[model samples]
Target: MVQNPERRTVLADAAIEVLARDGARGLTFRAVDREAGVPAGTASNYFANRNALLTQAAERIHVRLRPDDATIAAMARSRPAPSPEVLERELTAMYHRLAVQQIDYLALLELRLEAIRRPEIRAALTATMRANLEQNVAAHRESGLPGSDVDVVLMYLALSWLIIENLTLPGVLEGYDADRLIAALTDLVAGR
Candidate 1:
């Protein structure tokens, strides 16, 4: 109901923090307000209800996780397509970014679980996720990136779990060298 876009985004970001910190059941307008350090009813003004807030929070997480324009431009500017070795560095760097952004990744994981119980949330997220993956695949094809579409998907799945373990339970991957693992993934992508 609030007309201020900035205020709404602030509330949405606060909602992400609440979702990550307390999970879905604990995400209330009051909780978001508390997290945002706003007045008791401020979140109510921005969000009609919990579902609206949750969807907005999911979108905000996507915005946060997306690579910036500069990064995108650089990827495009590599000229004549980067090599499979470059793909290794690219995927490794991407994994590092995801791992370091602990809160955003954890909040996204929370949303995925919540989606299982709430179809609306699933619907809201599915389109955005599908589009993103499509864009990734399209870009890989257009850029002539060394990996195939299947390779991209494989890296997506593999890196996601790697990041999850790195954030949620670092000990699980403690002894394995990250560089070697990324090299192996790259090898898989190159079909070598």
Candidate 2:
């Protein structure tokens, strides 16, 4: 197979814009075509269908946010390494960023919602999310904590989702202060 960087770039960019504006339900071949200014047929040619497009778009997002191996190594070397306290703080920030950042969070939500109905998309999302979790687990492990344990990794994952869930829960915005949440998480991670 030949690589057409420009075409792939166009498709990927178009996919993100479409997802951002329309969510999963609004993403379709023709919609992307219009958004990307490409022929409908051409957009379809590249993506084959909506699922393929979403999977690629989600992967793109993952790639953009995931720390490169070299960066991870540098972090391992220079950083004081995370204690449970630091881990909690870092995760809380990540949760806040994802929830408050409209485009990124919305796109991720779209991928997740669609993944429920599409097995292929679901698998792709699971794999991508797993990779992200593993990276975090590795960092935690390197920090001289008990992070390498399956239990620690599982706990972090559960806590991360709780952050997301609480943000979306009813009355959370009215009752919860974001800064307080972050501070509380810091203490929680410290095992206070």
Candidate 3:
């Protein structure tokens, strides 16, 4: 189980870059090999297949979210209330960053579509989405919001999809600025 962590990180980073730049349609073993500056055989040896490589890349992403396991557990158990204003501000800033830099979202969206055709990808995507929803619900509960606030998580998820959908739709958000959407999401989260 012990291997060069650096090499594995490189492979994962390269795979993410390839997925972002080329979409799922262009993710290939050869492309990842080139991006990572590793031999094609090396990628094949590590990944075994395109799906394996993509799954690993997605796992790498899942490791880096703001509320990790510790945070999620604390939120689930803590009774202390947090100000939604701060969370709203943080969430808005994050969404703004994602929309402006769009690589991660594009990669995620591409993978999501690919998942529709692949069971493994679908499972991974479903798990990730569920985890995020659960995390958001935990945060809301910790912030003194009642457990009946399921709509908070639903709104959060819907607004996220709306941001991506607006970007994906032809000419829909061309005239609109990202800050506006970020503000709207913030307001939604704050129950304004």
Best by lDDT: 1
- The residue-by-residue lDDT of candidate 2 on 41-123, one tens digit each, is 77777766677788878777776555567966764576555566556655565566555545655577778888889988888
Tens digits of per-residue lDDT for model 3 on 89-187? Answer: 555655654455456667777778888898888887788877877877776665664323665665576567766876678377677666566556556
Q: Which residue pairs clash within candidate 1? A: none
RMSD per candidate (Å) reads 1.6, 3.5, 4.4
Instruction: Give the true-structure RMSD of model 2.
Output: 3.5
C-alpha local distance difference test of each model: 0.84, 0.68, 0.69
Off by over 4 Å in 3: 64-84, 145-149, 174-178, 181-191
Highest TM-score against the true fold, candidate? 1
Q: Would you list the clashing residue pairs of candidate 3?
A: none
Arrange candidates, best lDDT first: 1, 3, 2
lDDT tens digits, residue span 95-148, model 1: 888788887888888888878887878887786677778887887787766888
Candidate 1 achieves a global lDDT of 0.84
| Cα lDDT, model 1, residue 42 | 98
TM-score comparison, 1 vs 3, better candidate: 1
